[model samples]
Target: MLSYVRWYWPEEDRWNYDELDTDRWSLRHVELRGDGEVLAAASLAEALAARDSGGGGAVVTYERRFGVVPEAPFPPPDGDIEPVLETLSAGEFEQLWRHARNQLERAGSS
Candidate 1:
């Protein structure tokens, strides 16, 4: 089955949750092994033009990784926080993408 993985910055929540907000999230298409390990992954933009290689139907996982920033004098330190992951069904993924795309088009025209 095909799966989608999204990595986003939780700090960006200050801005409303815009699904198509490229600044907030990065998306990829992933293939998993039978044991649930990631077999391979590709950027969504690359996968969109290609056909599904077929493993499992699309399962979408959103991961939020939080980081801590130091005060002005110091540069933003880089560290990993335990990621929060959520999985959504293919149908829900399609709906969210469709809505976001429509919103983007409307915004562009305006």
Candidate 2:
């Protein structure tokens, strides 16, 4: 299980990782603040590299661990989950999300 790890802090809207917009990996492990902290050698190396490159907030060596254990080899769910939604295209789901987001934003701004 080797993978790229990233951390996200919602309160601060900060991410302790490289620019995700430019990162090529579609599947990744994104650890949030609630996941808890951990200190790994790879995370330490990244912090060290950041400091060497003159980046701020790079001295911190701790990383957030997802603590997630997915099914071995990752299989689909055992039962039907909104079979109608499953039949829809990915773009339709995205559009639904966009609409919901817009509604929430408008409500918040009201």
Candidate 3:
């Protein structure tokens, strides 16, 4: 139910998060725009957090894009994901990131 919404506008042709190279976790809800505007957005963390609201908020663990660990917990809503994501080994999570980067770079460079 959570998403790290990403978009690229061909005019500038850049990914349009508040910060580039900075991973984002939507606190409440946010709007993402591209082409003209309004691509997609939602209450990412809330949805994730809401799923396991009982105790410390359980994490649906998954390996990082290139991680050494079997599962990295989805970060708590208040915490940063980058630290946890750092556990990923170089080029370990390359499959997804490379594919997306290729697509976006191709799109942006065009």
Q: What TM-score does candidate 2 reach?
A: 0.25
Highest-TM-score candidate: 1
Worst 10 residues of 3 by lDDT: 62-71
Residue pairs in clash, model 3? 65-93, 66-92, 66-93
Per-candidate TM vs. native? Answer: 0.39, 0.25, 0.23
Which residue window of length 10 is worst by lDDT in model 1? 62-71
**C-alpha lDDT (0 to 100) for residue 106 of candidate 3:** 54
lDDT of 3 by residue, 1-110 (tens): 22333334444543332111234332322123333332222233434554467433333221111111111223435544332222323343333344444444454466
Every candidate's lDDT: 0.34, 0.32, 0.32
What are the per-model C-alpha RMSD values against the true structure? 15.9, 13.9, 15.7
What lDDT is reached at residue 73 by model 2?
Answer: 25
Tell me the TM-score of model 3.
Answer: 0.23
Predicted model with the maximum lDDT:
1
Instruction: Sort by TM-score, best first.
Output: 1, 2, 3
List the candidates ranked by lDDT, beginning with the highest: 1, 2, 3
